[model samples]
Target chain A: MWELIRANKRNSIVLMVIMASVLLVLGFVIGMVFFGQEGGFFGLMIATTIWLVLTLISFSSGDQILLSASRAQPITHEVHPQLFNVVEEMKIAAGLPAMPKIYIINDPAPNAFATGRNPQNASVAVTAGLLARLNRDELQGVIAHEISHIVHRDILFVTLAGIMLGSIVLLSQVFLRGMFYSSMGGSRRRYSSGGKGGGQAQIVMLVIAIIAAILAPIMAQLLYFALSRRREYLADAGAARLTRYPEGLASALEKIAGDPSPQLATVNKVTAPMYIVNPFKKAKQIKLSNLTSTHPPISERIKILRNLSQGASFNEYSDAYANVTHKKTIVPVAALSTKEDVPLRQASAEAGSEERLDKQMRQVGDIIRRVNQFIFLTCACGLKLKIPPNYKSNKINCPRCNKSLDIPRK
Target chain B: MGTSILIVFLILVGIPLLLILFVIGIYNALVRLRNQVDNAWSQIDVQLKRRHDLIPNLVETAKGYMKHERGTFEAITQARSQAMGAKTVSEAAKAEGALGEALSKFMLVVENYPDLKANQNFLAVQEELTGTENKIAFARQSYNDQVLFFNNKIQMFPSNIIAGMFGFTKRDFFEIEVAAEREVPKVSFS
Candidate 1:
């Protein structure tokens, strides 16, 4: 595990440096094109400043912003004790120093993600649909995957690399838009005013700048997504190792990918990559060779997971990964070397309790209502009454018992 | 001649300093692994305590409906007490296994009482018990993993030399004594 983390840290640093250089070069070329040779340094400064500020913002409150943007509600242990328990179980299994904060997104998409700079500060958010759809083992499998992200510090790497990508994309967009507006205003006059040789050189620089602006964002995104995709595999391996049950995660992935719900309402480009599966793309149509996809194809992932027939160790995962993908192993050799054999455990007894669809839906409805500050009252006839906060009547009759119950005021 | 003296001095002092630093690194690593093993054991203890605490409530909830099954309740109670009184890792493992067997027996007998199965309080207790059982199993697995890593480190080459010098002892794994308990009691309410 330590070996895996060290390798992850090294890979993140190398990728960050590569992305940073791309950003700096793009800034310099664009600067030269616009403000002459001196503007190159100035553009570099602006790029660095932008990167730093964005990094700072994300470092401080990225998780909070993500939770709020997704309309995820902070849940107590009482709201869903099972979710909390699963998180705790994963926390112990992963040996995380502290339990991550749990949030429930109101969306019906069966997806989840983890955020925060490190394990101690991490938060895991799952949609209500995830809760309603998956059994305890599948839920454990998903939580374990997210916790692996936290343990491996993938969140920090994603945030930093994402900030770099954002700055590059932002700078290029501004330059391109500025060029469009200025070109319409006639760049011909300035070209005629400059000396012939200098003007020619400037024109050449402008062409290079245009090309860089167009290509830098694409390059950065490819690099970013490549790293992101690899981490997904690693996290999957980590999840399998921690849970010691590859089938749990395998079936969970299938369930998540097979869901036909509308795309998550809160999903945007910036937040889409952090999700367990790419929120923008459907699982069935995604090809393994797609370059810009943030996550690997779900079918491939599920295949790799299901192929782990030997055990749940990192070595087993890598072998299974290789056998299914017909590609080189993704897990670091160091990780595979030190791993002890991890035999899978039997499925938990609750795996058989597939609740009726309406019951599951009602349970999720109640959870959302609880999050919305609705008061819950149980009638004598065993009917659950959920009163909205805006409910006007002080005395309401139970529909079944016809008994008048006074509202309990805070 | 002066350069030769400098080289000799550098070799003598630099080599020892590097060796000391190397030893310190190994020693600190051992300490870290030791503490991890200790911490993992404590995690198991916490889950074990939670299991012990929940068992009485579980028995109490079932007792109201299982009036004729006093033997099952008594067996569970005795096993729980034995688990609570366990002193060492192996002792706890054995006691916990007996307790698990008792609980599984109680659950099997519960199949006869559909009313008890439907009781809300009983259902909740069942959930808590199942969660606790999972926690214990996971905790034990991790604790054993930690112990395996630590033991391997202290017994492996190069680091073993450092470990010997530093008095780092091997930690015992929290192994289940009974093979039956290794397969966790399937505490499914359904």
Candidate 2:
């Protein structure tokens, strides 16, 4: 993931250089055609200055702006210790230098994002809905996915795209205003004679300028979205590598896709790509049209993830998505129940008048027991103990101290 | 003529745009690194608090078993105090080490009393404390990771240039200096 992030950073720099050169040439051509040589030169200068100023402001304050926009409140461990632990574990796994701060948004939608120009100054924010909804493994998967974004510096790409889009929109507006004023001035300057030819030429210029104004922003937005979609795929691949559990992320995506919430209040078009799942819920009413939207269809994303989980190659995953039907699978909630009897076994059996509740409790207890096997214990006798499956016997003696013990019956 | 126009356009507009994007990228990266460090520290804080919360219950559980082990109990309390009192990263690491050692010694004393080990309250507190310890270790690892990323960025090229220009300096990783610091002192029943 780190290597990919480094490569992406280099790629972004090269891309920026190419993009700037293209824009510069475009600006020059437009300037020369519309204005005299000196006017064209000054116009390009003004555009560059505007771009530079906007870029700097966004770079330095972009994370803060995004955080504030998302209404992400800074969280202490007291607020959510489980989240803190998962992030901590991931940070170590990634060999990061410092742990990124965690934040929680009050919204009920299950979504998460990482922000900061780099890992050190980074933060991971998740909706309160996510914390309440996801189990440990699912939460780990989601957080890992967000951390991948931070590692990959995808946020930088998104920010730059946004700036470019903004610049394009601004330039289009400038062109429109310039055409309007220029035509009005030309009208005032012309007295009689060849008014028809001059008026026709002015009208052609106005139409061209209006068309450019309307179309340029849309084109820029499409370009931005295309770049974002690629970054999302790259981030997903990076996350899968970092977690070494494609199923973890795949399951997380399944859950996110199944959720039926509207777009998060904090999200706008610009910050939407930063999320682990696209926070913006597409309108169910709209027909499938690739005409306007940014994100690749969520159903398709989940299918790709499912393919990845099956150990399919990335090429295979992509190919599978290309031909897969976009039908939603109705996953019965009962089928999702794995180890549901575990936690219940720990509950004292005395209060069980409700048979169904008792059955559910037993399921929970069973799962807890299975989970307990993973929990390491250091016995008082200075012996490391691994609880065995059949150790549920009446009197289990400690191997080192020969002390008799009663293993708690859960 | 068009080539000249392109060259002039690049010189006048292209360089500034590239510089702007680079600046934005570097600045955002630094901010992200800084936030990660803060997050890592908070994780440690949460675990420490959990550990601290478990201490009173642990001491109480041991109190009935080790009536004569007043010195060990006092040491554990003192260590916990020192750990809690620690403000800086190095200080917290040292204090936490002391607390772990003291807690282990206290646990060893409990080994002598079969009744204490059997007591559900003691077992619960012990289990909870162990869980907290695991959390702290994870948090420490995370903190170190973020610090590494932040420090590397400040030291690496291009971004480093921007980092230096912006007065962003490398941060020290929160780490246990000695193996002894990480070891929970062994309590022997023999």
- Screening candidate 1 with a backbone cut-off below 3 angstroms (N, C-alpha, C), the clashing residue pairs are none
Give the per-residue Cα lDDT of candidate 1 at A279: 81
Q: Candidate 1 lDDT, tens digit per residue, A1-410?
A: 99999999999999999999999999899888888768899989888888889889988997888789888889998788889999999999888999999999999989999999888899999999999888888999999999999999999898788878989999999999999998998888878887899899998999999999999999999999988999999999999999998888999999998898988889876677789988875554455468878888899999999888878888888888889889999987888778587898767665355454556677888899888889999888888889999998898899998999888867
Worst 10 residues of 2 chain A by lDDT: A340-349
Which residue runs of candidate 2 sit more than 4 Å off their true CA positions?
A1-3, A18-37, A174-208, A288-292, A308-410, B1-190
Interface Cα RMSD in Å, per prediction: 0.8, 4.9
**Candidate 1 segments whose C-alpha is farther than 4 A from its true place:** A283-289, A351-357, A392-394, B183-190
Q: What Cα-based lDDT does every candidate model obtain?
A: 0.88, 0.66
**Highest-scoring model, TM-score:** 1
**Highest DockQ scorer:** 1
What are the DockQ scores of the candidates, in order? 0.73, 0.09
